[model samples]
Every structure is written in structure tokens, then in C-alpha cells.
Target: MSKKHLIDRINTQFGENLNAGNTCFSSINKSKQVWWANIHLSKFADEVHLLLAGTGHFLWVTLPKDFVHNLSETFKIREDKNAVDLEISADKDSRYLIDVKSGGTGFDFRKYVREEVGY
Candidate 1:
């Protein structure tokens, strides 16, 4: 699927909760399977709940806002925006770099998935 198509799927899957209002951003690899996404937290007074549809697995992930506080501002998605170019590297400390093209930014959060939070 195309980038905009994929992002819309994710957003629609999370529509009910998104009533709180936040922008969801995403990017797809050339193969159109691998992808990375994030919800730009605004009015997210509770925790962050992500619905990654069509994965066939790990379809949902949830985390406290505090867990992503440091990198919260780096996430955003737009259909009109070009596919964001990205570069990643991990240091000895496991600190990874998410270099965005032309200064854009975002992510994939898996380990923090919580099954307990679901509709």
C-alpha cells in the first residue's frame, strides 16, 4: 500500500480514542511492508495507545506518555508530505539516532506494547 493509505488505516483503526485529538504520522519502506509510525501527543492526558493494523501480529501497543516524553515532539505524519528519509544508528549505550530528511522525524514502539489496554 502507499504511504498515505497505510497511515489512514492506522488512524481509522484508532479513531475512537483519537477523539482526544492527536496527529498520526507514518512512513513505509520501498517494499511497502515495513513501516514506522508515531502519534504526535497533544491532549493525550492519559497514555499512548497505538493500533498497528495489518501486521498480522503485534497489532496494538500502549505506553505511558512519560515513556516517550523525551522524544514526543519528533513524531508527526502527513499524507501530503513526501516519504520521509531516515537514517538510524545505535551507539555503545544503545542510544539510537533517528535522523530525518530535511529535519522531519518519527518511530516504532514495540517492546512497550500492553495488551491490557484495549477496547
Candidate 2:
């Protein structure tokens, strides 16, 4: 599919504003492009969000539920690696903090959405 179509599809699918990031994934080498999608899922809970990294020359984002149905039907995640990793710590003042590393199959956002979010 054309990059424009892909970007539109992605935006229509996951409500996260995507853009061309400086980082490029290995998969993009095969196709020669890079893109990223960041989404926030407040309905699930505050501060909870989903990030998508892929290889479409163009980028875009949308709501998970909005694009979930199409995503589930269109893409399939080839890799099972954790896309997002988190680390949690507690402080002496009874406060907790978390750190997250977001990485996963840098391919199709739809596939990532379906596998990660189970849409």
C-alpha cells in the first residue's frame, strides 16, 4: 500500500498522533522508511497509553477502539517481543515511580495494536 494510504489507515485506526521520529527500526531497512505512533488510552485508565513503532514513510495515530476492528482484521504481529517494558520503584516517602522502554515489531501499527492491545 502507498505510504499515504498506510498513514491514513493508521491514523484512522489508533488515536495517537504519529510522526516521523529520528529513530529507525531494522525492519525499515528492508523497506527504507521509519515512523512512530503514540496513543493515550484514558478510558482504560489515566496515564495509561499505547505506543507504536513501525516503518511507514508517513506517520499518524488514532483511538484504539476506532481502529481496533480494522486492525484486528488487517494485521498480524510476527514477533512476540514486549513492545513496552516498565520498571517500578518505591520511595521512602511512600511514593512510587515507574520507568518504561517502548519497543516492539517495527512493522505494521495495526498488527502491533491487535497483539499488544488485543483489539
Candidate 3:
């Protein structure tokens, strides 16, 4: 899916207005763009969502509940009773890694975009 499609999914599913012009957090000159949001997922807890979109790829993730306090600085997420700790990063090859840890169970997922549909 394209970047706009991703944002549209969030809007339709969550009833929130999220778009590149508003949520972007990085330099516009670069082909890749980063965005973030604090939103509630279904009836669960509120969480932080980070999105990275580029020419041929888009990476989106939902962090731990209520963990993102600021957008201008680097921070770490801590596991608490309400939610797990989540960490996301990307390698030089454009592979994205997601790590989530709770009381005892934790899991991870990786993504590397090969193509985007509906562009």
C-alpha cells in the first residue's frame, strides 16, 4: 500500500486525522519521512504509533501504551502493568524490526517493503 493508503486505514479505523503534512517529524528533503501519533487502539489502551514512509516503502508501528512523551527527542519505552515495552528500528537495508515485551511473553516482527500497491 502507498503512504496515503496507510494513513487512510488509520483514519477509517480510528476516526483520526493523520496525514503526512501534520504528523511528519523529519526533514522533508529526504525521500523517507517519519511520523508519530498518540492514539487508542480499539478498546484497549492508548499507544504511540510511528510511521516511516518513503519512495518504495512504508513502515508503521504501534508502541507501548502511553509511552511516547515527546516527539523531538530520543526516548525508551518501559514495560508496565498496563502494556508492554516496544522498540522499533531499521537497518541500513531498509528492514524494519519490531520488538515487544510484556510480563513474560515477547515477540518480534520484521518488514521490508518490496513494492507498494495503489500508488
Candidate 4:
């Protein structure tokens, strides 16, 4: 994929919702035939930086701290509004990354297969 293609994919998924003073960054690995991009998703409380990489046929995404926080907040709000048993367990896997394959309409942690962090 070319740089433009990568950028367009991010734009299509995120639109112009990036936080103020933030922009996307990208690069290509000619040796491996891979393309990657770094983008920030805008939120009312914080900004989440995501890394998207495509290897000709498939694409993957890596979440940052803001993603975890945002997800946690979502659960917290849901629990507060409704009475239900809810639990969330997330480890600080600084090296954690997953493919955009099949989680849900968005990044799916349940279906994320560990790449290398653990066997």
C-alpha cells in the first residue's frame, strides 16, 4: 500500500476527529513490503494514539494508553448508569499489538491472538 492509501484508510475510519494540534505520521518498509501509520483518535477526555500497519493483504492496529483509559471509562459509565455485574482486566503490555481482523465493528480484544509477547 502507498502512503496515500494508508492515510486514506485512517481518514475513512476516523474522519477529522483528531484532537487539536495533532496529526498523523506514517512510513513504509520497502524491504518487507509493509506500510504503517500513526494516528490519534479524538475524545472528550483524552487522545488515543493508534498505530496501523498493513502488509499488502492485511492490516493491524496497536493501541496506546489512551485506548485503555477510554475503554475503562466506557465500562465505568455503563456500570454507573445501570445495575449490572461488570469486570474489566487489562494488563500493561507495552508491547501488546493485535490485528484488525475479527473483534467487533471495532478493535476486538477477545479475538486478538498474541503475536510474540507470550507463546
Candidate 5:
């Protein structure tokens, strides 16, 4: 799926307050276009939701806002872009990453996703 689809998924589950060109999202559906000197709802940065969807792997994570508070100490600033790269590890062999961008911040999300169809 593309970036718009990701944002649409979020909007579909949540509400319209967090939509494109508006609302409290640092960036919805990250793109290489925004990888350099991007802009969005940085003002509402709190509780990061790391959403990944592709291939056979679909993972979503909720990180504490303070997770990226300390740059040099906790996170790594990407020399390649205007963003930071984060590493999220679930186990020794399984690790996820937030590469070149941070997103989906703002709003108290008790639930950011809802299943349209069950397994």
C-alpha cells in the first residue's frame, strides 16, 4: 500500500481531525519527498505510533513520547536526511526501525486501528 492508503487507514479508524494539510500528525504515510526538511504537526508531538505495512510483515508500535526526547543519548540523527533513525526491538532476532522520519504523533489514541475483517 501507498502513503495515502496508510493515512486513509488512520482516518478511517480514527477521525478527520488528523488529515492531510491539517490536524495533529507529525507526518502521515511517510514519503521520500518529505525525508528532507519536512513539515507537519510537530507541535502536537506526543505518543508516537510507528505503523508499518508491506510484504508479509505488518507491525504497529506505540512509543512513549520521551523516546526521542534525547537525540544524541537515545536516538540517532540521520546524516542522510532531516530526520532521525530509530530502532525498535521486539526480540533478539526481530527488530523494527523508524528510518529517516518520525510520525503519527498527537492525540490520545486509545485505539488507532480497528479490524474491518477478522481472521
Candidate 6:
């Protein structure tokens, strides 16, 4: 599908605020158990680093394999109200951290797949 088509699909499935950002295109692939989201966080935020740092919590819901490889490479788990900080490195070395918050939505892989991929 086209870039605009995919972005529109993602936004409709996820939320209207879902930004495609600088990375105009999204690569969808398949893996064992989940669907991954590989997009630039900046599209949803003004400053990625600042937003992550300010928020004590965020959720990292791993997408399926196809989407996983498309996302930013590295992810860091910031300090949360109930969890400790951690880091997950991707093969491509793209540092993309998703902060966890107490009030934030918990990790839901299936929901993401259903929304983004229309599974």
C-alpha cells in the first residue's frame, strides 16, 4: 500500500493523533506472536527526550515482528511509579524509549495488532 494509505490506516486504527512524522513510510512484517510499531516518536511529541523525561511512566507494547523491525532500534524503560528503569536495544541501534506511567495504558500487543494491521 501507499505511504498515505498506511498512515491513514494506522491513524484510523490507532487514533487520529498517531503521527507518521519524518518517516513517511511504515514497513509491516510478521513475526511469531505480536505486531510491532516502528515509527518516529517525534510525530506525536514536540521533543521526544523532553516528553519522555518529564513523564515518570509510559508503556512499551511490543508489536509483531514485521512492525518491530520497522520501529526505532533501541528502547529505554524510564523510571515508573511501580517499575524500575530498563533498556532494550534493537538490532538497528535506534534508541526509542517509551516511558511507563501509573495512569498510562498497560502493554497490549493484541490490541495494537488489531488496530494497526486490522487483524
Candidate 2 displacement at residue 70 in angstroms: 5.5
Residue-level lDDT of model 2, residues 73-113, one tens digit each, is 33232234312222211121322221211333222333322
User: Could you estimate the TM-score for every candidate?
Assistant: 0.38, 0.22, 0.33, 0.27, 0.43, 0.25
* Model 4: lDDT of residue 35: 29
RMSD of each: 8.4, 15.9, 9.5, 13.2, 8.5, 14.0
For every model shown, the clashing-pair count is 1, 7, 0, 1, 0, 16
TM-score of 1: 0.38
Task: Report the lDDT tens digits of candidate 3 across residue range 6-116.
Answer: 778767866776666433221122333212222222312443444555445555444444443442222323323222233333344442343322231223333332223
Clashing pairs in 2: 13-67, 14-62, 14-63, 15-62, 15-63, 16-61, 16-62
Top candidate by TM-score: 5
Q: How would you encode candidate 5's per-residue C-alpha lDDT over 1-119 as one tens digit per residue?
A: 54455557666766633334332222223433222222222422555444444344334434445545454443454555534443332232322232333443322222443322111
1-119: candidate 6 lDDT, tens digit per residue: 54455445555755644343432332322331112333344332331111111122222232333433322233322333222222222212332322222332332222332322421
Residue pairs of candidate 3 with colliding backbone atoms:
none
Ranking by TM-score: 5, 1, 3, 4, 6, 2
Candidate of highest lDDT: 1
Off by over 4 Å in 3: 1-5, 13-45, 66-91, 94-119
After TM-score superposition, what is the CA distance of residue 72 in candidate 6 from its true location, in Å?
12
lDDT of 3 at 36: 23
Which window of 10 residues has the lowest lDDT sum in candidate 5?
A: 32-41
Candidate 3 or 6, higher lDDT?
Answer: 3
Better of 1 and 3 by TM-score: 1
For model 1, residues 48-114, the per-residue Cα lDDT tens digits are 5444433233234555656655442544434354222332222213423333323445354436544
Q: Pairs clashing in candidate 1?
A: 25-77
- For each candidate, the alpha-carbon lDDT, in order, equals 0.40, 0.29, 0.39, 0.32, 0.38, 0.30
